[model samples]
Structure formats: C-alpha cells, structure tokens
Target: MTPSAPPPFSTLIRTASQQQHTEAESSTFMGDLLGGRLGVEAYARYTEQLWFVYRALEEGARALVDDPVAGPFIRPELMRTGALARDLAHLRGEGWRDTAVPLPATSAYADRVTQCARSWPAGYVAHHYTRYLGDLSGGQIIRDRAERTWGFTRRGDGVRFYVFEEIPNPAAFKRSYRELLDGVRVDEVERRRVVEECGRAFALNTAVFRELGEEFPLSA
Candidate 1:
C-alpha cells in the first residue's frame, strides 16, 4: 500500500483551530457591530483597541525580520499600524492617542503577541497568520458595514485599516500566504505548537470582544 500524503500545514492549522475561530467570529460584540445594531462609537472604541494590539504585533516584529520562520511572513504591505493610526485619528481626532486605552483583555492580548514575537518566531507566525489573514478575510465585512452604516468613504481614513492598498489581489496574496505556511521549516512537534497558538490567538481576540460587548451593551 502507498503511504498517504500528509495534510498541508496550512490546512492542518486551520482545521485544528476551526472551533476557536468560529467562537471568535460568533462573539456577541462582533455580531452587533457587524449587524449594524451597534453605534459608530462602538466601532471607534473597537478601532482604538486594535491600535494597541497591532502596535504590539508590529513593534516587536522589527527584531524578528531576519528569522527564517517569521521573516518571510513579515511583508511590509501587510502592516496595519499606519492604517490603524489613520483610522483612529479620523474617528477620534488628533488627540485620539491621548485618550485611547486598551482594556485589560486587549493588553493581555498584545502582551501575548509581544511574547511570541520576542521568544518564539514560529509562534509569532501563528499570531501573524491569525490576525493578518483574518483582516484580509472577515475584516473586509467590517469595512463594508462601516462604510454603509456610518458613511465612511470607500477605502478612506475611517475604514482604511481593512484596506490592503499594496495587495491588489487579496485572493492571490492569501494563496501565497498559505503556501508559505505549508513550507514553514519546523518539525511535527513545533507544527502542533503553532496550531495550538492559533487557537490561543483567537481566544485572546474573543476576550477583547467580550470586554467590548460589556462596555457597549445593546440598547433595550
């Protein structure tokens, strides 16, 4: 009998984390915010939280740019810090940074990304994959809703964080991204650790959403 082909690493990681991914997507805060039931203030607050998380993700990334596992995945075009800053400025004005604060969950989430990026590059890739890919995918839905619900211009400052100006074809970019994942240089044990980290990334995300939901409860 012929040996069966092993599953692609990208497929393995995604399939392993499907439940956590679903739970994060199904969070009540995301539901209301995406459903248009929540106000623009809620969206702005969410954006503020994102700024903190992305800053942590990107800031620590500079040190890892040379790592074989994490370097290939650190495409400049995928950086969200600048775009997130623009969105926050547009939403809350010039002094937005002064008042913006990460909830406990958001801080914890950013800390994890920092920890991974600093000590474990492969694990950093897991957080990187979880975030940027999700932004490229489900995050677009957010841009559309924000534009329609709050009148932000298409790809304008308010929703620019979701826009990948450098990546003209998101589908193609995603394919290449998955290819990189499939080719990542790691042993089976490390691969399983990366998959577990992906689940953890989504859980951290859900915690942020839970806090947001608490802060911005739906109107009766």
Candidate 2:
C-alpha cells in the first residue's frame, strides 16, 4: 500500500494558523468597523495604525529584495505605504502624518515584522503571507464597507489601501503567492518556524484590534 502524500506547505501553514486567523477576523473592533457600528473616526484611526505597520513592513523589504527566502515574496505591486498615506490624507487632511500615531499594539506588531525581516528572512515570509494575502482576500470586504458606511468613493482615496490597482486579478495573484510559499526553500524545521510565526502574526494583529475595540467601544 502506498502512503498518502503530505499536504503542501501552504496548506500546512494555513491549517496551523486557522484559529488565530479566525480570532483576528472575529475581533470586536473588526466586527464593529465592518458592521458600521463604529463611526468614520474609528475607521480613520484604524487606517492610521495600518500606516505605521505597512511602513515597517515595506521599509524592511528593500533589504530583503534579494534574499533567497524572502525575496520571491517581495513583489513591488504589493507595497501599501503610498496607498495608506493617501488614505490618511483623505481621512485627516494633508497634515495626517503629524497626527498619525501607532497604538502600543501596533508599535509592537511593526517592530516584530522589522525584527523578522532583519534577522530571519524565512520568518518574514510568515508576516508577508499573513498581511498581503489577507489584504487581497478579506481586505476587500473592508473596502466595500468603507464605501458603503462612510460614503467614500468606490476605491477612492479614503479606502485606497484596500485597492490593489496593480494586481488586476487578486485571486490569481493569491494563488501564485501560495505557490511561492509551497515552494519556499526551507527545510522542515524552518518551515515549522514559519508556520509558528504566522500564528504569532495573527495574534499580533488581534492585539491591535483589541486595543482599537477599547478605544472605540460600541455605543448603547
């Protein structure tokens, strides 16, 4: 009898981190924001936190642009800093940068991404996958919510961060991204580490949402 083939690495990672992913998705802040229970200020504040996190994620990408483990995932089209900045400006005017500040959870999240990008390129893949793939997937729900709730123009300035103008086909891009993950040149030990890091990334994201929930509790 032939033994069954093991699941692909992408499947392993996703299955391993499924709980954390669900928890992040089900966080109160996200639920409130997506449900339109929160006001536009809450949404703007959330976008501000994203700006800091994406800056860290993208700023570190330049150093890893040639790394064997992380390089393949560093597609320029996935960059979000400029889009985040545009969203902030539209939400908070030209001086948004002056007022933009990271929540404590956000600072920690960004710092972790920076650390992984600088020290462990393979681990950086966990963060890259957790974030950009998520943006291409569930993040669209956010773009739709923002448009409907806040009356932002469809894929316009306020929600530009969620729009992937470069990737005409997000579903296709995500499939290719999963292929990269499955083919990553890591041994079993490092693959497990990357999987663990994916969980950590989701936990960190949930922390941000938890803090935002505290900051913008639902009204009676």
The digit string of per-residue lDDT tens for model 1 on 34-101 reads: 88998889999999999999999999789998999999999999999999999999999999999999
Each prediction's Cα RMSD? 1.0, 1.1
Which pairs of residues collide in model 1?
Answer: none
| Model 2 clashes, total count | 0
What's the lDDT for candidate 2? 0.93
Query: What does candidate 2's lDDT look like per residue over 70-117, in tens digits?
Result: 999999899999999999999999999988889999999999999999
- Give the per-residue Cα lDDT of candidate 2 at 90: 93
My TM-score estimates for the predictions, one after another, are 0.98, 0.98
lDDT of 1 at 105: 99
Separately for all candidates shown, the number of backbone clashes (residues 3 or more apart, or on different chains) is 0, 0
